[model samples]
Target: MAKAICILTGNHTAFGVVFFKSDANGCVTVKGEFTGLTPGKHGLHIHSFGDLTNGWISAGPHYNPNNEMHGAPQDEKRHAGDLGNVDVNEDGLAKLEMEIQHFHLTGIHSVIGRTLMIHQNEDDLGRAGNEESLATGNAGVGVAWGVIGICQSNISEKALEEKSNQ
Candidate 1:
């Protein structure tokens, strides 16, 4: 019913595109691809703020409106914004596709106007024994980030007419 898109960019010329859409089944579907990162796993999460003035730092901590500890996307105790990680291939390209019920467009946990971050290292899934694991998931510095925004639907009259004719 609604859609959102982000143009991700960050350290070492890292960049990617992501789309957040409200699926027909009342769930959110995330689909996108990223590149210009190291060949390995990297953290991915939705941040608190949408402002990118100071890059990733300005986005604030992971969106934890529910006051939950950091954990894997599949973990029942993880933050609402915890999206786990994106695995880059040998050429530093990552294609991401997932459906998560952690957030919604109409709720206190809504991700609208927030930002998504891509960390420099793999997220340990908050299973590690480190002190910050419960906070940052042991994910290293943010290498790339993007602001999430509601998508605008603009249809051309010509396209509408063509569709009607079909």
Candidate 2:
């Protein structure tokens, strides 16, 4: 049982708490929240590797642990990093929670060294008809990016304790 948390801030948006849970089988549960964003559906995914070198491009490919071809989140043939989209309300806020069982947040196949990207548009899931669609979903531009890090559970617990003490 391990935990990870990240705070993501970007153009016209600010948010905190991207929670992750590493399971026994090397899967991860990804949860995210945001206070501001365009009121609409937005795309979310685990980029290839954790290296925000040159903007979003540094993240590279989806977390396809099985080396499967691209497909929708629910599709059987899809990549491992496909967690699907998140919806934002009229207040430009979002609370996203989903389980990603195909990839790990720790160990050899971990996604820790990878980055999570929030796109400005919905992922058509390769329905747009193009080769690049499989890898990128033609999902417009990236609005926010955050490097995933493994946060020890004790750290979060201590923070909670400090808050209670205060």
Candidate 3:
């Protein structure tokens, strides 16, 4: 299985770490944990670039190579970066787990070189009847962001080669 990781950072005290793993079936599982967040829904996505030379905004927009409109994770027309929302608890801690089909850890559509974006507000999923909604799900300003990188797994190189041949 292919794997990746993102360690979130920003101008605030909030922090987050996310993991991505791919199964043999081509589905990618996203798992993450966060702290110091406002109690509510927050939009989570994968931005286009991993550049952080000028901070989070330098990461660019959502990873929409296909030029699709912003929408929910289940929306067939949503951008590749649209992973929907993650709910934060009153204690300011959030745990996330989801399966996605639009992106992967390897291959041409790999997200390993992209960036993860956490928005300040809940994603309207393009149903807000506004242009911003259709473009960004109206996710508001990015509160935190991180670059996705290839993770060195504990699995031995021999095992990885064997799995790839199967």
**Could you say which candidate leads in TM-score?**
3
Comparing candidate 1 with candidate 2, which one achieves the higher TM-score?
1
Q: Top lDDT: which candidate number?
A: 3
Query: Candidate 2: lDDT of 32?
Result: 69
Better lDDT candidate (1, 3): 3
TM-score each candidate. 0.89, 0.83, 0.91
Task: For candidate 3, write residues 1-166 as lDDT tens digits.
Answer: 9888787878576788888889999999888888888999999989999998887789888999789999999989989999999899999899999999999899988999899988899999989998999988888888888899887777643454344336
Candidate 3 weakest lDDT stretch, 10 residues: 156-165
Q: List the residue pairs that clash in candidate 3.
A: none
Alpha-carbon lDDT, every model: 0.84, 0.73, 0.87
Candidate 2, residues 22-43: lDDT per residue as tens digits?
7776666667677667888877
Ranking of predictions according to lDDT:
3, 1, 2
